[model samples]
Target chain A: MSVPLLAPGDRVLVKDDWPEFRGPAHIRTPHYLRGKPGRVVRVLGGFANPEDLAFARPAPKRVLYHVVFERPPLWHEGEAGDDVLVEIFEHWLQPVPAERQAA
Target chain B: MSTPARPESLARLDRLVAALIAKGIVTESDLVEAQARTDRASPEVGARMVARAWLDPDWRRLLLGNGAEAAEHMGVSMAGAPPLGVLEDTATLHHLVVCTLCSCYPRAVLGYPPSWYKSFEYRSRAVRDPRGVLAEWGTTLAAGCRVRVVDSTADYRWMVLPMRPAGTEGWSEDQLAALVTRDVLVGVALPRLPVALAAE
Candidate 1:
């Protein structure tokens, strides 16, 4: 899968349906931030997005996005190095500032 | 550093083993022998290899790219296991390995992974906050290096071949391996040579 090229320092948000592991569950995309915010640091990999497979839907032809987050900013009281970057499919993402549309 | 396993899970494992034995899938004696064999393996071999490689750049590269192959070069077979990958730790990036699904390890090279490496606490927390996880194991990284925790599921298992310490001019492989501890190879600890220790 070819992910749209994401440069360093590009602002992006965690896709709503990104699988919530122990980190994402407690820190980045908690219930409060279900529709909240984030930014992209680096592109991690190109592979089948977990959201599509988990939902048992047709594979949406999109690349996975990996974004990083600081712990304090994400969870307020989250510990140091709680900086997390999650990978999500394009279908699950929407523009955050209401101006930028997800590519 | 042992994480508590659920009683139900333990019971399930016991039941599974019993069933395996009853069905003749695995003999009780065979299971006992496997356990004893594993217990007899030591981490010293891996540590020694790491130390020797640290002093030798060519060997270090081989170790990182193909751990099993590198093991064979050092007289370690790494036989009876799947292929293994070795992650090299630099000043800016540290590596930690965990078996998220099960304790898949490179027994031939590094010996058995510490019990904590297979625990729920290590598996769940390491990916989330690897620095905190390492700190618990009595390892602290330099300020600049970012920690990258890797998962070793059934598909791929990892070992961290740490960077060699500075100031050892002509150290033998044996001397170097002595400095390579099990924790260092597992990515929980850093390699510290006598010179580096003195400087610190």
Candidate 2:
């Protein structure tokens, strides 16, 4: 019964220079989103942490959030036509003031 | 079983299943249930869901609100799988799904994902170039429409409830379901009213 983290439509910042969730693991957060700014779209529900699941270890459930990122901020190469919504874990995210958007 | 090229992988899978059974993590009945679930995976299930949604406003509201529940109501077992989210396509907005980290899919309702869905190029580019990718797939939206790319980076899997096509005033649910394809369910393609049933 952990407190739910990050509600829908809250702006959050992905930590900069944080190490990628390493292999020999089942991490679901994408590498490209590191240090990026996005808004939480919704709380996707709690699931046993996959990093522990990879080793058959008992995992405490963690809240997963669907965060929406502007295309231009994520990748500069392609046409900035769509907003990319990624399902990220609560541990990888931190809430930010709406005015201070980018990391 | 039709994937003959991976005998080694198949053997490895057998060994893993055997070990799971030995460890009491899963039983023979569990294995059978898993297989039965996979066996039932087909685009027909997705088509039926979409067709039902199109025909019934109450069903449509439920499907849009809780897709997994809607699937279960029709006997599509979603137990022990990720939550299902249906993104409805509209005149102004469209949705496309990709698993940038790995392949997370709504397997219970939509069956297996297409090979291209797991490719590195699709994973990397679909987020940035949805319109371009859809264009390459022969689907192009008209002016003023916006596209949204949903990355399945976690256990929350998404499927598209494609816009109901034009024509066919008196088509049956099965007839409408026939027009729904894996491509349409994934949002790369849109269902078209069969040419034979062209409307006035």
Candidate 3:
């Protein structure tokens, strides 16, 4: 699948999907960050799909993104202004819906 | 240092290695060479890079702009490893690194990840309560300084270029590198002027 690359400053939302792979699927996204809103911090370029590498299959390259999230929204006790940056693959990210973005 | 592998786990690994060797998938020499390379990997490699960046502005730009290339320039072979990302800590911002899914680290530069780094407790708390985790490690940042936690969740491995400690104005690169420990590189602790020097 050809996933469009996201640029810095673009707001994106992480997908909240769970893999039902029987064995190890090598999904790198942490469960907590799933479905969270974040801003693209950097375009990290492409890397071999780890999911395919884990199963020793022919892995296609996928674009990776460095996305930054605010701490307060992630945790109740999280201090304001603190940020969390997560490296996410293009396939797992979606454009933030208009209504979902905070004004 | 990580905990020693349990005997059963070790035995299982041995069986796996034996099976691979029997299938001609891997040779004993390949395993030996890989072990040797891992043993040679150390935090000093990262410290040296930090020190050089402190002493040289151009070097710092290179390190931050392209960490893997910078490492290769410094004679650290990054063959077969994913790209390296250096997180710069500034006066108003501090950077911390963690791998939530597994123990993915900048092994080429900082050697193996510490046992605590791979613990479930750290992985959970780092994202949930980073300030609390830093406090436990005795690294208290300024009240207004934002702590940016960088999760090395995907293909990129990250290391912190900790802010240079005060009171070391005329120090050499070697001297500066000495102050940067593994904890400081990982952002669990901040580099500090030694107590004696601070008192002076």
lDDT of 2 by residue, B9-116 (tens): 889999998999999999999878978879779878888999998899999999988989999998987787788899888988889988888778888888887788
Reference-based lDDT, residue B157, model 2: 79
- Cα miss at B50, model 1 (Å)? 1.2
**Model 2 spans with C-alpha error above 4 angstroms:** A21-25, A101-103, B1-33, B198-200
Deviation in angstroms for B25 in model 1?
Answer: 3.4
Q: Determine the C-alpha RMSD for candidate 3 after optimal superposition of all C-alphas.
A: 2.2
lDDT by residue (tens digit), candidate 1, B1-200: 66689999999999999999889899888988988877766788678667766777888778766777887776765676666667777788777776554566778776777777778777677655677778787887778777665555322356777877765557787767777888888888887767656676
**DockQ for candidate 3, C-alpha atoms:** 0.86
Worst 10 residues of 1 chain A by lDDT: A24-33
- Which structure among the candidates has the greatest DockQ? 3
Question: Candidate 1: DockQ?
Answer: 0.09
lDDT of 3 by residue, B80-143 (tens): 8889999999999999888888888899999988889999999878877888999999889987
Least accurate 10 contiguous residues by lDDT in model 2 chain B = B191-200
Q: Native contacts recovered by candidate 3, as a share? A: 0.97
Error of 1 at A1 (Å): 16
Per-residue accuracy of model 2 over A7-99 as CA lDDT, tens digit each: 887898877644433435555667788888899988878888887887789988998888998877788755545688887888889899756
Where is the poorest 10-residue window by lDDT in model 3 chain B?
B1-10
Which sections of candidate 3 miss by over 4 Å? A1-4, A21-24, A97-102, B1-3
